[model samples]
Target: MTYEVLARKWRPGNFQDLVGQEHVVRALVNALDSDRIHHAFLFTGTRGVGKTTIARILSKALNCEQGVSSKPCGTCSACTEIDEGRFLDLIEVDAASRTKVDDTRELLDNVQYAPSRGRYKVYLIDEVHMLSGHSFNALLKTLEEPPPHVKFLLATTDPQKLPVTVLSRCLQFSLKRLSREQISGQLKTILESEKIKSDAGSIDAIARAADGSMRDGLSLLDQAISFGAGELLVNDVTDMLGTIDPQGVDNMLDALQDQNADTLMAAVASLVQIGGDYSQIIDALLLRLHEIALAQTDKKLVSDSAGNMDKLLKFADEMPAADVQLYYQIALHGKRDLPLAPDPRTGLEMMALRLLTFQPVAESKPVTNQSVPKTEPAAVSNKQPASTSTSQQPAPAVTASAVTNTASEASPAAAIAPETSKNITQNITMDSPWTDIVNALQISPLVKQLCSNAAMQKDSTFDVSLVLDQSHGQLLNKDRELELKKAMESLWGKTIKLKIELGKPSNDTPAATKKKELDSKQHAAETAINKDENIQALQESFGATIKPGSVRSRV
Candidate 1:
């Protein structure tokens, strides 16, 4: 006996056997049970999404020997012949092969005649979009009005190419691509029924590689079983699919979190030995990063079926959420750039290096006066002898005022200075301006933006009150608030109790102050430009006029 491929062997025979098309199945079942079926039916979706299969099943339902009902008796001659693809009344046409006007007219010529054996003559046209304009024109009239015993079933991967006249005459039911979970569930069921030795990890890898297509998933499963010598193994499937092992991805991520470049390179070398596809490798890494990011938002959101929830949660706790997002973006771009690189290996290596080079330095222990570096400023003249008199000039001492000013100059929020560094180090009282505290804390831009739009006040020694502006209410969330609270507590060297409320700020927010400072600087720059002697000369000699909004502050 010749072997049949899994895709063909496991084709759905009825509505109940079909998976991940509940909407289409429900409508068709309703129509059949109520005996209100339409003359023409059109099905549209991507490849491998059950467009042709549903058409075949509907054909069976309409022509079943038991009667015209949704539930067809498979043992009946009409159902058995339909399932065997030998039903005389079921005329299956591949529009792609015969797309001429003559072919369409010839097929429709017999539509007025009654079905020979079954109750109805079912016309199942696959890839109907391939029909030419003349063919569609020929099909329009018969498809719109056929004999009492005729039913038209048209299926296409591209419905947009179908003529509006033909489309308007049919009751279209679009089939959706199956989700990963849906596809995986179906695969598990098939494996159990087949008694195939398989594991969850291998099934998941195949399902993910399927990319929301049931036919593709079944085809891949067939290949995987053959590759594994009649058994499904994770290593064999990963190798067959050219996807990296989940453990390998985890190792690379662990090395990255540790900032161990050597370990990361070693992990890559192991992957090279396995001969995995670089593009798929990057995709796997990106998927892990996405999971880590989601886990950071909420640990419970991560799926446990992959047997890596603990690893993901640990990564979420150790690696900063910002780094996860950054790495994901870099990997995504790197995947796109892989094909243009000199070679796949070089592209992946350079991308890994870029990730390492740009990763932000881990936060250091709280900066103390003792840890601050003291050194001489740049010499005025390089022409002088090596040590003629540079050493004789004592370096200026670093002061708290200088530190405060230097810190304030680093960020726009630092424009509102309230206390010296020495005072803040010794004691951070409620009287200290929120801007000053915010400027000193190390946090992500999202948390910083949240702080910039809120007014902070002290309710007790360790209690803080925040009034967030109503305009930026969307920024108020638990994760960001927790991150901001942690940064502030670290800077103050004490645990803080925070209470947030949505309303108008009693004082100007840091964002408002920054805007004001920016406007003042813009006015100063414009005034200076207007008063410049060279500018005046140019205006007088050449009638040159400064364009509005062109002047920008350098300071």
Candidate 2:
């Protein structure tokens, strides 16, 4: 006898053998047990997900000589013939091949006739969505009102293509894709039954490669067994599938956490030399990062990481969650654009470099200067200072480098406060308070227009008082004053009292305001330098657009 492939060899013969479709099996079994079968049944799902298999089983249940039972006895003639694909009463048609109106009419023409061998004549049409418009119209009437002895079972991956008229006549059942664990378990069972030796890791690799399709998983297993000749191993499966090993991914992550670019590059080179996919490496790294993030939130979800869970959790604790999320996004985009790059290695390196370059800087060390007493330290005599005369004299002089280092270690904020106050004094002109308040209000368009022509009332206690013109003052109602106050406080980081007084218009008008704006713009442009670190980075790296009206704070 010819050797059968694993897929066909492990085909499910009954509902009990079907995996990962409990809902579908339960409904069909209940219908069969209760003798409440529908005339037309529609099974829809992607390929290798038991759509057609369920149809075959249902056909057997309907026509089995043991009666319409959920568990049809395979010893019965009807079940045996159906299983062997020679049942006279069950007609399995491929709508993809015969998708014409004439073909549909010819098939439906015999629908009115009684069953030739069993209680029901089942028509199992695979890929029914392939039927043309005219063919669908031709079968609609027959599907809606088939003879008592006839049943229709239509299966399609794309059910949306089927007309509503055809869909309304049938009872639809959608089969779900099997999960990874379910697929792995089923493969293990099949391999055991076939007496094939394989490790769990190899089975898992095949399951992931299959992507939730049982037949695909079995096909992958068949290839793995043949490749192994007898024993299946994880390394062999990885080599066959061109998948990177979990250990390599773990090592790459370790390199990243250590910020050891040399180690990262070496690991990547090894992966490339071994014919591993660079994009898959990035994808696996992203998966590991996600696992690490979850592990940080809950320890139970980190069970699948072998012995690396503790290390991953440690990395997670050290790194901020935002950094992990950003790297994950970068890795995902790298995977998407990997094929477009000149070489996969180049793409992978670019992604790794991007991640390393953006890692957030660590927080600054705390200032540790010992505070002197408010009253100042007590003075000692110069010639025979208390106890210093008997002690060995200090070194002749301190080096300039030592003095500079001591001063450099001092807190810059404390050292710079006096200098900052002097600069603030010089810049505070007679009209500085008014101008600053106006500029702060300019942050919002509405407030800017309302206070355009307002005049400033100079007072020592009140930072800057605004007297709005009649029309504009009316716009700055009580609610608007509160809004302006909030915006000013946010900008200044302190409260500046503003008393809004309605009065006659000042000489400063909107036309004068326009002229001042142009002068201010020119002054800003002349003072602006391209050496600003943020602007330079934006221009050189990302080519950011700097709009004219955008505000910049004085550093």
Candidate 3:
């Protein structure tokens, strides 16, 4: 006896035998039972995802000798011949090979005739999209109005190429790709029945590599069994698939989180020994980072099926969320730049090291007894960075008098004078406490714009009067205003109604404040550099000019 491939050998004999396509199966089963089947049926999906198989099963169900019913008796001659690929009435055509007008016409020439043996004459055409325009034109009429005994079963990976005329005439059943768990469960069952000894980890690796195709999973399983000398092992499967081990990904992430350059490089060396695909390693690392980031918000959402939940939860607790987000972005950019490296290993190494450089400094939790100084604006800014620790101190209540004449006077405390209603831009006074609150609000970008650019006029009983530049009228909407209001409510711990008004803003919007802050820092740094004796001496002796825009404050 000749050996058969697992995909062909274990083909689904009926709807019950199929996996991960309950949706298509249920519709087909109902159609078959109700005897309300359409003349033309189309199956669409990717390769190895049961487009052809479902067509074949539906063909058998329609032609079963037991009668015209959904539940086909496999022992009957019609079912046996269909299974054996010798059913006379069941005409199977590979449209990829027979896509010309003549071929299509020739196939449909006999459509008007009745089925020879089975109750229905089933024309099972695979890769129907390969048919040319002329072929589709030729198929349109017969497919639309075929004999009562004739059923058209079309399958294709590319349905977009098919003519609208042909598509409109058919009932399309889309098949979905199988999940990793579904594929793995099927693999476990197959292995148990085949008497193949295997561990769950090896099966998992195979299922993942299958890329959501049951046939592909089975094919890989066959190759894995052969490679393992009839025994499925994780190490052998990993080598066969060239997939980096999950543990290696964790190790690299561990090294990155710890900022341990030596451990990171060491992990790379170990991967090099295994001849791992660096791109795949990068992808695995990206997956780990995503899981860690998700874990920070909801620990229960992190998956432990691969047995790494505890590690991820621990990393989430230890590594700053900011760092996790930064790592994810860098990893995405690194994949794009991976091919530019002299070698993948060196590229991966540089990316790993760059992650260490960008790791966020874990914020120190604020102490409860720490007093917020009322006099110093610098003190408030220092106490709160863009991202702070879990332990937060309630923001000090700000009074209107806290700001200097420059910050508020830039934007007058009084209602915008009628003269300022035009395009006149006023410079707000400095030292306003509003900018600090805006920065600390931690709202989304849209709401941030509304808050940042608006100045809060002192309102009674925790209410805020917001003034936005009239030019930004398009950005203001009821939804955005509500979201902005909610953010303020959360921050101040009081229900505050926002009174929105359009005028020339006399106060510094968050955008203006940020620009002012940057300009001030840049000027101070330049002045300091110019004042340095060493810099001046070097310039005097070497006739060197400080490079334009080179002096930037660390702030």
Best by lDDT: 1
| Candidate lDDT (C-alpha), each | 0.77, 0.70, 0.73
- Write the residue-wise lDDT of candidate 3 on 380-403 in tens digits: 657777575323333333422433
Q: Compared with the true structure, what per-residue lDDT tens digits does model 1 show for residues 1-555? A: 887899999998988999989999999999999999999999999989999899988988998888888888878999999999999999999999998889899988988888888899999999999988888887888876678898899999999998889999999999898877788899999999989999878988898889889999999999998899889988899999888888788888877765545677777777777888898788889998988888777776765444366787888876766567667866786788888777999778656644553432221112222223443234323434667555534433334455554444334333232222223443555467887766666775657777888997546644789889989999989998899888778876788788888899988988788777657865865685565444454346434455333343534
* Runs off by more than 4 Å, candidate 1: 298-310, 336-343, 360-555
> Once model 2 is optimally superposed onto the true structure by TM-score, how far is the C-alpha of residue 511 displaced, in angstroms?
65
> What is the C-alpha local distance difference test score of candidate 2?
0.70
TM-score of 2: 0.62
RMSD of each: 21.5, 23.0, 19.5
Clashes of 1: 0
Candidate 2 residue lDDT tens string, 1-555: 887898877778899998989999999999999999999999998888998888888888888787888998877888889888999989999999998889888988888888887999899999999999988987888876778888899999999999999988999999888877788888888888888888767887788788878889988888898899988888899899888776677777766655555676676777777678787788778877887778756766764413344677776665556557656766776787788666877777656645544432222121111111211223222445667744523422223344444344333322212212222333443366454445434233445555565777766767657777776555777777788778666656687787777776554644256556646754453244233333344345433334332222212
Candidate 2 wrongly placed segments (more than 4 Å): 294-320, 336-342, 361-555
Q: Indicate whether candidate 1 or candidate 2 has the larger lDDT.
A: 1
Model 1, residue pairs in steric clash: none
Q: Could you tell me every candidate's TM-score relative to the true structure?
A: 0.63, 0.62, 0.63
